[model samples]
Target chain A: MTARIGIVGAGLIGRAWAIVFARAGMTVALYDVDVTALDKAREAIRQSLVDLKQAGLIEDVEAPLALIQTESDLRRAMADVEYIQECGPENIAAKRGIYAELEAVVDSDTVLASSTSGIAASRFTDQLSHPERCLVAHPVNPPYLIPLVEVVPTPSTSETAVNHTMRLMALAQQAPIMVRKEIQGFILNRLQGALLNEALRLFRDGYVSAEDLDKTVKHGLGLRWSFMGPFETIDLNAPSGVVDYGQRYGPLYRDVDRQRGDDDPWDSVTLAALDKERRERLPSQGLADQQAWRDRRLMALMAHQRTVTPS
Target chain B: MTARIGIVGAGLIGRAWAIVFARAGMTVALYDVDVTALDKAREAIRQSLVDLKQAGLIEDVEAPLALIQTESDLRRAMADVEYIQECGPENIAAKRGIYAELEAVVDSDTVLASSTSGIAASRFTDQLSHPERCLVAHPVNPPYLIPLVEVVPTPSTSETAVNHTMRLMALAQQAPIMVRKEIQGFILNRLQGALLNEALRLFRDGYVSAEDLDKTVKHGLGLRWSFMGPFETIDLNAPSGVVDYGQRYGPLYRDVDRQRGDDDPWDSVTLAALDKERRERLPSQGLADQQAWRDRRLMALMAHQRTVTPS
Candidate 1:
């Protein structure tokens, strides 16, 4: 029998999740409270599928499109699914209400996963009867092109649920990393937040311009990082390995961290200036067009990634 | 006449710089006080050229190889060169002595640039007779593959020198970003240190494993970063643009930064643990092989980058 997957929201992420499951040959029931959102989601999903097909990421868009069924009724979407991915709003109250409704309608055997970027599964699932089956599977934006899904399990989450989610994600051709404990911002966002903090600080201090800082990354660090992680990068950097690398440059990084001190670069004043600088480069009117460009660039990169064999 | 370039200290960075200049059809005179280091650099350059040829980054290895001439004498290497890329050991005193010697040997028209990763140009060039002509043109390691060059000028450095160096780097097909002011760790290392610090904290606190953290980067954040930078990323991420993104997520990042507090994650204990975790995955004996693999992956990525047209 074909596996059934339930997506509990039909927003951007929900629609992307539908493509993911459908591309993996699973029957996806994408549900939403708003009829207009469901309609928009269907159109967006179709456009994305067409983009994916053009990138050679999917063999036939029609096949995947045929597999997904959009429904406005929550119970109808929840019925007969082995797993449910809750893609509701990031608000805790909204998540709580949705999960409660999902639990009341779905079978006890059905695993519940929330697509929260920072909120822990425990926050919403702790009051539920079957909290053991709930976990957080935070994904990068546009999960189809970017394959990383952070599988975070709360203390109430069962080992079986975690294992099942990991297997399912791999089956869907996504890279799943286990976050052993619930931490604020999860893994991906925390790393991004760290870098963003420093970047903001640098720009605020007038040390470097916004454009130059971006150049340093896209043309420098981001190149190696595209293929290898930081640990692997440092491991291969020094003569011996990670230990040698630590001995050589660890102190320098330590000094820099200490020097960073307690300056909060996320202050509104700094952010406003940053926004001003960014606007100077790309006005607000051009954001949608630039976003489309970014998406196309991501698709091209993903397509290229498929051709290269990583050592 | 083809422009001549001098590469002081024929080590890894120096040899890579030789490739950068030579590949651009410049006559590169790679100089080192140690004869053995020069010979080794020659062989390494030849091997790297062959790799570049195989990657289709260069049309012919022999053409670039024939352009690079290794020399044991500094005076001979400095003669008739339009610019000098000093890749000597990262010691202040050594740099001071080398610059003093270089200032005496080179013509007033020649631009003297250093490949010092962190040191500001003023640190060593202040005492030189021609400090105005001296600046830092720091390149990412293996410059031929990763093409970012941070052109940082000291307060004493002249605008002419900075412009000349910028033009030269661009001509070499490198992405050059100007550092408006002298700062610790420049731009790249500071950003890297921030991320590494956060990664260490998460690992030390048992929130995530070393391998998973890396996966979050390589598979998640790194994908978007390869094409678009953090600023541009956030700009496109929100529907409206940078201001919209800041308004929506700025508080969250601020909260995360504030929550981070002043607890230093770069202590010895954390680093040792990080080293242990890394060695377990990539044993010490396999470092050399893995380094080679990293280079090949970088080559493949660069080769792939050439085929894609970024929007």
Candidate 2:
């Protein structure tokens, strides 16, 4: 039997979720507070699927399109669904209110997941009638191409909710990693923040240019990261792999972190300096075009990377 | 005048450096401690360039090969070169001995850069008669394709050395980031280690499977990373970008750091479990074949991605 997925919020993310579930042969019910967002979302889904098909990443879009049922009625959308993916506003108050309503309407067997970026489940779900089913299921933008979904569950979240969400993610073909315990920025955001902070620091210090800094990842470190996790990378990097790599350079990383920990590096000077360099590379007027370029490039790389090692 | 590059250490990395410089229209003179290693290095260079040419990542290979010179005399290789990239074994004793030899031969204007992965310049360069010309120019395993070279300069090193090396790297078509001060693991390794340690922790806590953990990156986080550094990603991730993302998740990352501090989850039990899963997905006997497949997949994806946003 096909699993039914109820997505509340017919924005791009919600529609992407719909496409994801529908592509994986699951029934998707997409609902939104406003019908206008729903209409735009529907159009976006069609355009996105066409693009995916052209990229040879999707097939049977017609069926998934047919499986999508759009409705403004929240209760109607929630009925009989095994999983409810809440893509409502990232507002804590909004989430709080929605959880209370969702708890009353959502079946006990159903898993209720939020698309919130960083709000703790324990805080939002605490007031819910069925709080155990609530947690964060943050996906990177354009979920159709980028599959990273950070799954963060609170102590109040039931094991069953987590399992149900995980299975749903699996069936939807989304790659999800549990946050284990709630913390700031989740994993991706934290790691990204740390890197950005350092890169910003370097830029601020006039150690490297913005273009060089960006290329440093795109052409350099990114090549391995696209294929191997950081661990597997170090594991295979040295003659003896990880241990040898650690013995030789662990102290350096430790020191970098230590200096990084210090260095009162966070200041307006750094951000503005970075902003100027970024604007120079991509002015405000051109940022949008550059972003589109980024997306298309990502698609191309994904297609290529899927076929070979990055080197 | 053509930029002359001297590679003193005809090991795999050294030879690869020669190809990188030669392909970029620089005259390359490669020297090795062992004559046999020199011969082996030539064969490796031949095969590697063939692959590069096949990939269309290189041009003028014939000329580059002709420009390639081999010698056991360290002084002769550095005679005409303006920049020297040393890729000797990553041992203090080895570097100390090599530096003394290089110092005696190279003019003060020549920059002596070590390709050592871990040891600081101060560790070995302190003994050099011309230590100002010495610094750590660490590259990821392969510099030709993945162009991230972390340039670390000791306190005693001259700023001119950094500028000269950066200019040479730019000419060589590499993405170089300068560490204002020597730090561990440079940028790439530390970011990698941080991610892997967390991934291990997630697995240890029974949050997810190894395959899923791997997918969480390849299909998820890495897709964005292939183009943008971690910060730029968050900068564009939220409506307001990086700052907004920080406001939302920065505290959480700090909290995670607090809980996860001192937890080296990549310990024995976690390794055993991960190894078990990895073996199941890819048996030990099939490691070689699987690796080949992985390489191919990465190539295809890279090709596709390059044409789009991946490159």
Candidate 3:
């Protein structure tokens, strides 16, 4: 039997989730309060599936599109669904209100997950009667193309809920990591934040330009990172593996950290400088076109990754 | 007239430089003190060129192969070359000795560059007679495949030398970023180190496993990084631009930074655990095979990149 999944938002992320679930042969019930937003979501999901088919990431768009159904009523959307992925706003009050309404209509057994990037599940889920069944299963933007999901669980979340979420994400072909504790920005954003903080500092200090800094990643460090993570990269770097690599470079990293200090380096002055350079390269008017280019490139990269077997 | 390039040290990196120069229609003089190493380097260069051709990274192997010549005499190898890429040992004494010999043989007009992964150019090039012409042109390992070259200049290096090196790297189809001031690890390793430090902390704290941590990169953050860098990525992320993105997430990044105080977290216990997991995924015996896979994948990615222009 096809599993029924409820998506409780029709924004960009919500539509992407609909495609992911539908493509995986699940019956997706995508719900939105706004009728116009729901209508737009239907068209967007259809176009995204077509894009996936054109990129050779999906076999055919028809079957997946057929599996997705739009629902206007909140109660009907929650009806008979085993799992519900909430893709609402990033506001704590908005999420809390939605959860309160959702808890009343949904079965106690239905696993509830939020797609919040910053807010932790504990903040909002603590108010729910069945908080054990609720957690945060945050997916990267455009989840249909990129397959990283951070499966974060609150303290009240049951083991069963976390395990089931992991299984469902794997079924959808998403690489989900179990984030044991709810850290700020989760794992992806934190790691990204670390890199961005340093990048801003470097740019502000006049060490390198915005263009050159980007080049340093795309052309240099990013090449290896495309296949391996930081740990594995260093693991393969040294002769004796991770320990040897640590011994050689740990102190140097310590020195860098000392120089970095405890303060956040994301100053507005640096951002303005970054914005000026970015605008020079790509104006605001051209952003939509550039984003489309990014999506196409991402699709092509995904297609290429499918061809190579992971080590 | 084709530019002449001299590659000192016929090791793996040296051979890779030979390919980069030769493929760009430059005459290459490859040198090594050991005869057997040079013979092996010649065969390796041939095989790598063949691999690149098979991967569609290069048009034809014959043209590039024709441009490379192995020379036994140091003076003959350095004769009239416009640029000399030194891929010698990381040891200070060894580099100093090589620069002394190279300074005597090579014309003062030639731009001398080292491929040291960690040592700053100022440390080794300080004693040289023509320090103004010397700089560090550190390329990621296997430069024939990866295009990032850190063109680092010492305090004594002249602007003419730096500009010429940048021009030469661009001609060879390698992406070169200028390191305005000499810093530890240059740009690539330092950025990599920051991420590694955080990753170690996460793994040690039991937030995520080694395998899953790598997935967070290869499957998620790394996908976008392979093409556009973090800055450009955030630039296009929000509606307004990078400034808007900063406004939304800068505070969150600040929170994460505070939590991650000044501490070097690459502990031995965590490394041992990571090593164990890595060895399990890729046993020591299987490393050679995995490395081959990595090279092949890099070649394929490079080929793909050629098909699409950066946004």
Candidate 4:
């Protein structure tokens, strides 16, 4: 029998998840209470499929489109589903209510995964009868193009559930990393937050401009990071490996960290200034157009990546 | 007459700078005290030019190769040079000595730029006769492949020198970002250190493995960052712009930052363990091969970037 997957929200992330599962040849039931949201999701998914097809990422968009079924009724959409990916609002109340509804319909063996970027599964699933089956499977936006899925398990999350989610993510052609313990913002966001904190501090202190800082990443560090992680990058950087790299530059990094004393709150004033600078470069009205351009650039990069093998 | 450029030291970075200048149609004089190091640099530069040619980055290998001249005498290399890129050892004493000799030989109009990653130009140039012509123009490992050059000026550096260096960098086809003030690690390394500090702490605390952390970056954050910087990324991410993104996620990042209290020292035990983990995946003997592979991947990426227009 074909595996059935239930997506509990027909929003942006929910629709993207639908494409991911449908592309993997799984039956996807995308559910939402709002008929307009469901209608918009269907159109958006169709457009994304066409984009993917044009990027040479998909063989036939129609096949995947045919596999996804959108329904306004939650229970009807989740019927006989082996796994449920909750893509509800980030609010705790909304997540709890949706998970409660999902638990009432899902079978005993169904794995419950939330796509919440920051919230832990325990917060929403503690009162449930089967909290052991719940975990967080956070993904980057537009998961069909970017394949990383951070699988974070709470203390109550069972080992079996984690394994099942990992296997399912791999089957869906996504890169899944296991977070052994639940941490704030998970792995990817924490790393990003770390970099952003420093970037904000630098920009605020007048060390560099926002545009120049972006250039530093896109042209410098980001180039290496695009292919290798920091560990691997440092490992290959020095003569011997990571140990040698640490011996050579670890003190410098330590000094820089020491210099960065106290986690200063991201002030609104600095953010406003940054926003103004960004607007000067790209006005508020041109944001949507820039976003579209960003997506196209991402598509082109993905296409290019597929053609070359990682060293 | 063709513009004459002098490159001090024939080490890895120096040779790369030689290639950068030579490929820009300048007559490059690469200087090193040791004859054997100069000989090695010539062969390495030739090999790199061939690699660049194969990657379709340059039209012809011999054109650039023929433009570079190796010299053992510092005075001979500095003769009639328009700009000098010093790639000597990163030691303060060594830098001070080299600058003294360079000041004695080079013309007053010639700009002196150091390729030092951490040391500020003011530290060594303070004693020189023409401190106004000296500044730090740090580059990534291989300047020919990675185009970013951090054009950092000391307080004493003249506006003419900064403008000349910036124009020179642009002429050489490199991306140069101005550093308004002197700081530890400048921009790129500080940002890198911030991320690595968080990564090390996470690994030490047993939240995630070295391998998984890398995947979270290379596959997730890196995919977007490869083309755009974090600032531009956040700008395009939200509906309005950067301010919208900040309003939505700034608190979450601040919470994460606050939770990361105290800049803990990167312990040796953790680094050893991390190194062990990396060596298990890539043994000590394979480091050189991996580095070569990284370069090839970089070349391929650069070639791909040249073909596409950034949005």
Best by DockQ: 4
Off by over 4 Å in 2: A53-56, A59-64, A126-135, A152-163, A178-185, A197-211, A259-269, A306-311, B54-64, B126-132, B153-164, B180-184, B193-213, B254-302, B309-311
lDDT per residue, candidate 3, A111-186, as tens digits? Answer: 9999999988999999888999999999999998889999999999999999999999999888889999887888
> What RMSD, rounded to one decimal, does every model reach?
1.5, 3.8, 1.4, 1.2
Residue B31 C-alpha lDDT in model 4: 95
**Higher-TM-score candidate among 2 and 4?**
4
Clashing pairs in 4: none
Residue B78, candidate 3: alpha-carbon lDDT: 86
lDDT of 1 by residue, A111-183 (tens): 9999998688898899999999999998888999899999999999999999999999999999999999888
Q: Cα miss at B116, model 2 (Å)?
A: 2.2
RMSD of 2: 3.8
Candidate 4 residue B273 C-alpha distance from true site, Å: 1.2
C-alpha lDDT values of all predictions: 0.87, 0.72, 0.89, 0.90
- How do the candidates rank by lDDT, highest first? 4, 3, 1, 2
A207-262, model 2: which lDDT tens digit per residue? 66666667667666676667766555554554544445556555555455555553
The residue-by-residue lDDT of candidate 1 on B129-190, one tens digit each, is 78999999999888988899999999988999999999999999999999988887889988
How far is B28's C-alpha from truth in model 2 (Å)?
A: 2.5
Name the TM-score of candidate 3. Answer: 0.97
Model 4 alpha-carbon drift over 4 Å, by segment: A263-265
Candidate 4 lDDT tens digits, A263-284: 5637889998898889889888
| Better candidate by DockQ, 2 or 4 | 4
Best of the two (1, 4) by DockQ: 4
**Candidates, ranked, DockQ:** 4, 3, 1, 2
